[model samples]
Target chain A: MERLMKIDRRLLYLISVALVAVTIFMPLGLPVKVSPLAVQTYDAIQNLPDNSVVLIAPMYDPGAAGELNPMLKAMLYQCMERGYKIILGNTNWTLGVAIAHDMITPIAAEFNYVYGTDYIEFGSKPGGSVWMQSAQTDLAGAAIVDFNNDPIGQFPLIQAVPRLTQEYIAAVLVLDCGTPGAVEWLQIITQGTSIKLIVGEIQMSVPDSMTYVQSGQYNGMIAGSRGGAEYEQLVGRPGAALKSQDTMSVIALMVALFIVLGNIGYVTRKR
Target chain B: MMWLLAQEQAPVPTLGIFSAGSVIDFAIVLGLGVIIWVMVARARTGRKIPEIKKIAGLEAVDEAIGRATEMGRPVVFIPGILSVDNPQTLAAFGMVSHIARQCARYDTRFLALNCDPLPYAVIEEITRQAYLEEGRPDAFNPDDIRFLSAEQFAFTGAVIGIFERERPAANIMIGAFYAEAMMLAETGSFQGMIQIGGTAMTAQLPFFVAACDYSLIGEEIYAASAYLSKEPVMYGTVVAQDWLKIVLALIIVVGAVLATVSPDSTVLRDILGGY
Candidate 1:
């Protein structure tokens, strides 16, 4: 019993891994409601005039893949369905190419949304906020080229599309897992522009982003996995995000309950 | 009519209990709340405890603030990038208040750079109260509490600029930080400011630890306000948090034992597994 109480972290980690594996395989078909933020984001995409220009800032890395990817997929689906053109760019240097080359390609193919017509991914731009301000002023000049060194302008989609300023951008969808992401859009462009902005932020950033939502600076914000699940509900379809909600709820309740019971045990023993 | 229709379509979300695993969670929450109430009652009845373990990151506040005061430099407090509603940020602001009072008592200036507008308003009041508490309400400079642009890197860039221009002696960054965590701490390091960083950002903890002179990890960030303020309610909360930790430890132990002893036991797993 004493040994169990002081079990090493590696063993604990292994057990946790096993638990996660088991849970993933065992689906509970959990019920989820759409968040206002996700619905607003979906509506913004759904309501956009077909062939409208959307700039997606996928500013995150692999660590946040589990949280942000579902929202990205849903957004892509909506854009393709609505016939809006998307310009995919990254603020994070490392994850930018992977997102452009690996994630978006097959998904776009599934929708038969041909490259250079429906979407154009202009790989990663390294400069953080400075890059955002530059992007607002000059899009082609800012992102410069595609995943291939080929000029972004060479692509039929790129050549035809005007540069992204307040005038050209229909909406800015930011999937952010870290700082310097949505804040870049909020500060650099959205403050004075007519371009609508929505953020898909991780759970931790929810409270902070809510202040932005309250201030009316951001159109809407989808927070963490829960927000993504909620967005799925609003779309009248369910995906991985919906299933993940139960897992999250279960985990949160587990932790909260354990904390409560532990105090009771301690107090009772003392008495 | 639209409002009524919208309400009809909207399903009320289940507030609690979605799966069998939820049973454990409900039990835990209920148990902990009861324990906290009992503990507070006992304390009120005058049961004094021994000195608790020291948190080194906490002890350095006086040194950090004193150094800033001695150098006739302002103590720059980044109350976090998040708003006042976040429990972590709110707690961090409480500690910032104590530090601000120290700065006032020493006749040193206090500078707070904020990101969110709402929290900026709340923190402005916190700074004001600190100066008033120190009997130097006149020293409180509302402008010193600035609403930097709310964008993440934009705010970070501004903070970087503040460090360059003001050259504050101590940089106390206590809140929920992310990638910009390193950017802020590294900038402070370049300026030769004694940097102290604290957050519940588990992934970003390593960056702060590497760059900062002192770093508060995990629950320590939550405990900071209580430790600094010495208020009874805050102390009571820490006691609650401690009880929570012990319960968590026990759950993990029991869970490990059950899995090892009977890997194939559905009943045991049900008793343990979440929804």
Candidate 2:
């Protein structure tokens, strides 16, 4: 017990790293349990009217990509399967454009989704809430060019959905990390309207977002990485998040073991 | 049919300048402004005001500075990673002015780290003015005020490096903060610095409480300047804010009761909703 108490911190760190690395390479078929919130989120997207247009706003940078990216991919898969016309974009987070475009382009091709009529990528625009408000009135004016910097007027999708209104777009799925995110979408675009707002939030911000869900201000939410894994399963396209579950479980157990060992060592030393 | 035809034929009256939906909101704002003005006037006329409750976090500012002075080490102040537009940032400016004055008076080195260029300029000016006012104009160092980075984690990394190298005796963080709050607070704690943190960001408050020696919770950061300055006029504004809070609490209670009694009643809802 005395020896255990004196175990080097570096050794513990190495063990944790090794476990994570092993899980990354080796297969561990861990079953992921879906939460009710994820179910609601899946249903919300699944229930959208066919051929309706939906806006996917990736409202975070690389800092939050680990959690939000999986959610975005899962949502895209579901939305494409439903044959919903998609508009990919955000305001103020330029880095999200590349992240989202990389995932969207390939998945879209798999579905044989057309570039202009079936889907469009507006990339990232400047101005936060101000851009959201302008898009509500004049989306083309707000976003003059697509991801390729081509005139937005050339895209049939842009012409089809001239403004972010209930008559045009059915729902806005926002992957939020910070300010001018889902909250701004709710306040500026969808409040007091029929347009639905769904969100994917980081784990740290899940509690803050619950009020919006409870109040029916947000139609649904993918809560976190756990939520992302569950959603991927629901969408019938399990990916990275599902594989991460095995690593997370092992890490959780390791942490608990360390806590117990430390406590035991302390107690024995006192005696 | 004839009445409907006549109504259609008649000219519709235009709405007044202030929209009907915003009348209640306008009235509430106007009322609060008037109350603040009245209190300020009374205070200026030498009327005694109620004593403010002590804020332990702010009260320790002097002790933190004195410790730094005694140890012959510098004091660090991070106004947060935001521009000057945020109200929290503006509030931080007020506290920074006070802290700079104290540091200048004590002949202690003060370092202000910034993430935004706009606030960086303003903070430099504030620090200079404070030192000039304290008759220590020569003590103000331009190099001490730095604009680290615009990116969040990048700024955090730079600050961490600064902590390791400078090894300041006190770390004062007051303003809006986000994910980087924990990293900075924990680093300061590791360095054995007396850390005082204040922010209106509710999510980051828990991290500050766990790491810092003293922390100002939500709304307390706003009151810090008035408490430190002891300006009667500022006290009046604080008193007015307290009174408004009381009024808001009453309104919430009444609204809840009304909502329970009559589910169909949209009176309180409409009035509070302001549209």
Candidate 3:
């Protein structure tokens, strides 16, 4: 019992790593139970009028990519499937541009989404909330060029949505991880309006964001990676998030086992 | 008949002197300002102000600096990964000045690392001013104040490298931190440094509490400078904040009762709900 209590920390680290590797390679395919919030999020997107335009703002950088990227991918899948015109962009998160473009381009191609018609990428702008305010009034003026640095005027899709108002855009689906994110959108653009604001938040920020959902400030929310996995299932596209569900379940179990084992060792040692 | 018809056609007179929606907001601001002014005036008149409760994290600032001085190791201060536009970062500036002044007095090396260029310039200026004010201007080194990186994890990596190389005896983190908060606090703990952290980011507070020697939670960071300086005028502001909080608490309780009594009542809703 004393030996068990005094097991080397390095050995514990090794066992955790080995478990993660096994789960990643040979997924147990654990079922992800969809929550009410994820269902509401899906329904919000699904119920948009046909051919409506949505502003997909990936307002996060590479640090939050692990969680938010999957959410963005799943959202894009849903938006494309619903035949909605999409505008992908962010502010002060330049790194997210490449990540979003890579994910969007391939997915758009699958849906036969024409670049200048069905979807467009504004890439990253400089100002944070200020940019959000500007885009609300004049999106083209705020974002002069596309991801390729070409004039936005050349794209018909960009011309269709002159501003980020309810008249021009149906909804704003924001993947938020930090400041000047979903909150900024709500404050600057969508507060007291009919423009739907749906957010995909990191697990850490879910509790903070739930209030907005409850207050009807946010039309809906995709809570975290679990929310992403559930949403992927709803969209009938089981992607990275669904695949990682098993790994998450296994890792959770491993952590539980460690806690119980450590407590047992302590009890035995005291006796 | 003609008089009654004209009366019905005429627009009703506008209520109050101020704009319909702005009166309450204006009054609240005016009330807070008056309270702060009155308290400050009272404090300036040499009246004994009520003592503020001891904040453990702030009290540890001096001990951390002294330890670094005795060990002949640098004291590192990270003012968070945000621009000075944030109130949290501004509050962090007040802390940095206080810490830097103490370090100057102790003849200890102080390093200020930043992730934003705008705050980097401000921090460098603040540190230089602190040293100058302490009559140790020569101790201020431009190289010690560095802008690590705007990227979150990149900044964390650079800070970890600095921690390994310098082996600082104290790590003071104040301001708005996000995902990198845990990584930085854990690294400081691993380096065996006395860590004092303060941030308004509630999500990251748990990590700081877990890893730091002392952590300031929420509004404590804002009150830190006032507490440390012990200035009557600053204390007045803190007192005013407490009073305002009490007023808000009363309003919340009253509002809850009213809401329960009359579910259809929009009185409280209209007053507090809209911006």
Model 3 lDDT tens row, B1-275: 11011111212333645533456777789999988888777788877666678887677999999999999999999998989899889878878889999999999999999999999999999999999999999989999999999878899999999999989999999999998999999999989999998989989999999889999998898789677766666778888888999999999898889878987788876775353
The whole-model lDDT of each prediction reads: 0.75, 0.87, 0.86
| Residue pairs with backbone overlap in model 1 | A183-B151, A257-B28, A257-B29, A260-B31, A260-B32, A261-B32
What would the per-residue lDDT of candidate 1 be over residues A120-234, giving only the tens digit for each residue? 8888877777787787666777767777777776676665544555556678889887656888777776664567888888876777678888867778788889989888777
Candidate 2 residue B209 C-alpha distance from true site, Å: 1.5
In CAPRI terms, where does candidate 1 land?
Answer: incorrect
Clashing pairs for predicted structure model 2, backbone only: none
Scanning candidate 2 chain A in windows of ten residues, the lowest lDDT window is: A1-10
lDDT for each residue of candidate 2 in B184-272, tens digit (9 for 90 to 100): 99999989999999998878999999889999997888788678766666778888899999998998899889879987788977767
lDDT of 2 at A195: 77
- Give the candidate order by descending DockQ: 2, 3, 1
Cα lDDT for residue A88, candidate 1: 85
Model 1 vs. true fold: TM: 0.53
Angstrom error of the Cα, residue A154, model 2: value is 2.6
lDDT of 2 at A22: 95
Docking class of 3: incorrect
User: Which pairs of residues collide in candidate 3?
Assistant: none
DockQ list for all candidates: 0.03, 0.16, 0.15
